[model samples]
Target: MKKSLLFLFGLFSLWSFALINFKGVPVFSIVEAQQKTQPLTGKKVKTEKPVTIKRNAVTTVLPVAQYPLPKGSQWSYLDNGSDQGATGWNQLTFDNSAWAAGAAPLGYGDPVATTISYGPSSTNKYITSYFSRDIQIDLNTIGDEVEFGLRRDDGAIVYVNGVEVFRNNMPAGTVNYLTNSASIVDGADEKRYFTTYLPKSVFQNGVNRVSVEIHNRDQTSSDISFDMYIRDKAPDYVCVEDHIACFTSIAPTSQTPVMIIPQEHRFQMLFKQGTAYMDGSGTVPGNHDFTGYIPSVGATSSALGHLSVNHENNPGGVSIVDIALNQDPANPLWVVNNSRKVDFSNTALVKTERNCSGGVTPWGTIITAEEATTSGDSNGDGYQDVGWLVEINPATASVVNYGNGTHEKLWAMGRMNHENIVVSADGVTAYYGEDGGTHCTYKFVANTPNNFSSGTLYVLKMDLALSNDEPSSATATWVQVPNTTQAERNNVTTAAAALGGTNFNGVEDCEISPIDGKIYFASKGKNRVYRFKDNGTTVSEFETFVGGKSYPITTANGVVTENWADGNDNLAFDDHGNLWVVQDGGLNYIWVVRPNHTQSDPKVMIHSSMPAGSEPTGLTFTPDYKYGFFSVQHPSGSNQAQPDATQSNVIFNASAALVFSNKDFLGQQQNLSTNPVVALNSEIQVYPNPTKGLVTLSLNEEADKNLKIEVYDFLGRKVYAKETQTTGINQKETIDLSGFKGEQLVIIQVETGDTKQIYKVLKKDN
Candidate 1:
């Protein structure tokens, strides 16, 4: 009977697993079960036929629906320079049977589907041209909101079902056939399509009429074009886990540009250029580039931190902002609390120029790289001081002040077209690269740990010959440069080159791999990323990690092809040790190279594509690795606007800072032990499993014993450990894991005297 019950239980479990449903229908079902009994022996036997279930078709309803009046559709047009008084011509009831018919766009002076006469002479053209189309709509098939994408040169007035809808570029009040456009159509705006929404109530159930009149800025405007498309107003994109694969690049248009991210990730625009600071210091500056996030002291909230943003302008400044995270699950957003700009007027280095890519030190300070160099000695210190690393205290939102009138500039590090710097975990060793022309990679070792005021600077010198045309490998060494005096430091670049420093082309960024502690940097001019094991005084296994060769890339349409031309620029590493390369010159694609990728067969994937006229800069991840921050610099103003994951309208037509993460993978909480009750002793409990930063441990039962708490990462690396005495019946302890990188699994071991228990916990970013 026990054996029979066990078999029945197995059948029940299988049935339970098969009952899981998608869209209210069971994905699979078990069928054909039989039981036979032996009468003489009074025994029962069971047998089942092979189970088969039909997979049901699942349908998806898109948020938007296009109307029949798509762009390039045939239209009835009148361009004979004849004036039909406004009323009769725009009404659906008025029939123009004699009007010439042609497929849009219909105009002159530019490419069009059908060329129309521009009046009698080239200098005296028609002022107005009328076009109309009939569209069929099913009320049940579309939403109540309707939108129109209209492209026109000079000016236009659109009417739907004889009702005036919208007017563009034309003066207010009454308009006639001879009315001129308010402004001349020129450059990109002339060919750009403007979008507007209207009520679906303007149309009947079946046939609807859309009429448009195009008017030139002047009688002899020299050009006129018009084209339009209509669709139900709804969201064009949705972020769903495993549902969408990727977002492709878009061209410059009047519409807003959308960010290209993995389909599963959710993107939010935290701040934009020109945003007013809460402190009233000033609005956020433009030409945004580098972004560094510094977690606040004892901060448990994922959103609460200091964010430093670099302005890459002639007179650049770093903006420090205080941010907080919203806890509402339905509307998770990072809120900017306050902001202020770093002051530099009082220091020897009166001002900073072209503040570009920078790094956050291990000891919680921001070091902004001054990318532009000047020959003038403004401080009269016998050395040019414009191009140097300036340290800022984010908490104070000002430059770190030394004694006298001097400020935060690291004079010993030398000057060049400094792109970015990366400090090692020890905070003593730093690596940086130059950004323009023929530059060299350099390293600096602080005389004392965590202090950059004094350091021994060295330039990289490789043994093997380096070439820009092909992949190169070599063993390298860091050769010391003469930096004992200010003049020597100012001319460090020249001295380094004299010491046989390998002249790498445009080294844009440098980063340290979390998995292996190797140094990686991007040579934008050479189109490659190189990695080397920094063995203190020497380097080993120096080779190109990615780029400089053809690698397979999957296009948005699912076609795989080889792409050899990539101008790799910025570099970042995720918790999983994947190197993310953001391109600046070629295709502007963000590529992800796996940790185990080999030079012979590089394992790379196209993660994202930037919009036209824009380059991605400053890619950095939070400690939990659940979120990342980056900037879209100098995108075309004509890029279209799109709705973000929260249904908020966002436009990337200008420089902006954005954050993104995988939606489904965010805010997940787990305990360390397989069974919390057994391992935690029932009396011990951990609250707020998926913590923003702070975690609390509570003990309810009475116990007088020595308690030890420890945390270990997946790699068995001890990240945190603490010990205390439990003197009372109830005890509580708070653990701060805000500084850990990426959303990761860590084991927590709790020991009370001879009894020890382990629990698995998931640390996340919000």
Candidate 2:
């Protein structure tokens, strides 16, 4: 059965990527002709757009009451030969292909998803849960008590014969989280069961089936570690494997994020939990200018959560990455100048012209996907032949290149259009999702398992769950990676088969929550996020985002109308147990989802004006939840001939970096001022101060978007011009400054978007 909730998000004009055909009905709210406020007079300011998204819930069979072993009946979990069902607890390190394939009846990828499960037949067997035909252990041989140890991080249920003996009733993490990303990987699921003190007759003289259902939440998050055995009875059993390891028992690893700065100064809290500081001396330029940053140090999310990006659709400014300084909820955030400005030039990775997606690595590095292959040759080349993942150094502002430094080499992973890279907490596994044809989900086990570049990649055959599909809803089953030519993996047919079926509307963004470690990826066109059970064969669907919030708004005295469509681009968990994501719709806004709502919906962390006037694109949390970064691509779309082009700058009005603190919308801005450079007095020249047509401005070639432009008359009446654009280092702008011409002294100011820009333009005597 299909059940969904509600979520709401607005829009942001960013990324020329993912060609969007808004169906002409681009859901947005035009800034009505209202009176203007300070700094923005006469021009329409796109306000918030109220919208609602449906939360689709996947109805699955809940846990049922289990009975005791029956007389002369078959039980589960037998340790005969061939590694039969319910093999109590065994280290699953070698030959995963065999175990994953052998445990077919137990299920693999979620049955309701388009995931691939390996086993005897597509009809049965998935290695997610191992059900057995019971094994008889001599009760007298027992030390007195029986114990089943487990390290399941998500959900694990055990049953004897058809009777449920043990249940890890850990409720699933709430869905529809908008803010407060949890810090640290989801804890491992290690549990133990015991019956040593029970009467020997509890183990009857017959066999039993040790049926177990283990939900992984997500691949990287699945930590199934346990040892089941009869131990000496009494509290002393703690000495046994069951309760052997506590927080102190587990080996903890320490990590530190990389940050390089040419000049040192105070750090600014962009998002929160961490702070990024830079010396404004000669090293930094403007809002988008910085040598490097000091990342907020803290624990990581419970699972793979986020990716950072910068949108550059300039000239109009539909996207503006806002990094609030205040992250604490109880703390009062005081605004300051902690905002760091960035553009495409200083950071070439953000300016990539090819089809690229971002993912985090096990080593706190950025991994970008090279989705463009030889096929889409814009110049009509025979073959571009370029599809691989690129590594980026966030601390050094550097990109990983080939050993020779001449070309950037791809990682061991094969060439394909990757959607997400869900990294594990222990830095051992990386799950990459390739969307296109038959979708392929690949696992990179760094634990020396299998060969390098060749562990095991499975195709999700969502068709296997047809038995559970309801007549009223659409459903599919999952299977293993189809044994086919590697070429098929790159083609569309294989991707479809691999991801269950070709019935997907459009699958995109994939993320794992930090609190629960559940893997979530969406079929953009389908507007759904699927939660794959650890047993790998089960799947569930949830909905909670579309437009604004779940509630509808009535204009003044008008009736209430609901609009849903929260363009979920990507999602990430923060250090403070919050979910952060960027929405792409006509209404641009950044959203922060709370952890546990009734239906698990995302709370609006910060909702800004619509894209018609501003921008807030994709977001990524820093190592520590202290500071986060967001990309503000173009914000307006008045110039693009084809409004649907992925790289069009139609919604770019102006771009600036916004900083927050304590995760508060009104967080205090950190001191961003560095050692001031020699402010040039007569070096810059901007022309046509009061031209009725077009006006052009030029900078020192190295100056950045810090050059702000504004016009004023003798009476101190300010007129609106346009903010310049940034690329590489310098800044420039050409605006139709015609509307404001009845001025005596054409006072032009040029400075950072915050500080007053210096200007001195003499009015021409017509």
Which number leads on lDDT? Answer: 1
Which lDDT tens digits does candidate 2 get at residues 313-432? 121011112222334443333233333322223222233323334566556556555444434433332223445455555443346544543333233455556545656666655655
Off by over 4 Å in 2: 1-352, 374-384, 401-412, 432-455, 463-503, 536-563, 598-609, 613-615, 637-652, 655-657, 663-766
Please give the distance, in angstroms, between residue 596's alpha carbon in candidate 1 and its true position after superposition.
1.1
Q: Name the weakest run of 10 consecutive residues (lDDT summed) in model 1.
A: 57-66
Candidate 1 C-alpha lDDT tens digits along 355-448: 9898989888899999988768866767685888988889998787755465658888888889999999888999998886338899999998
Name the top TM-score candidate: 1
Q: How many residue pairs collide in each prediction? A: 20, 208
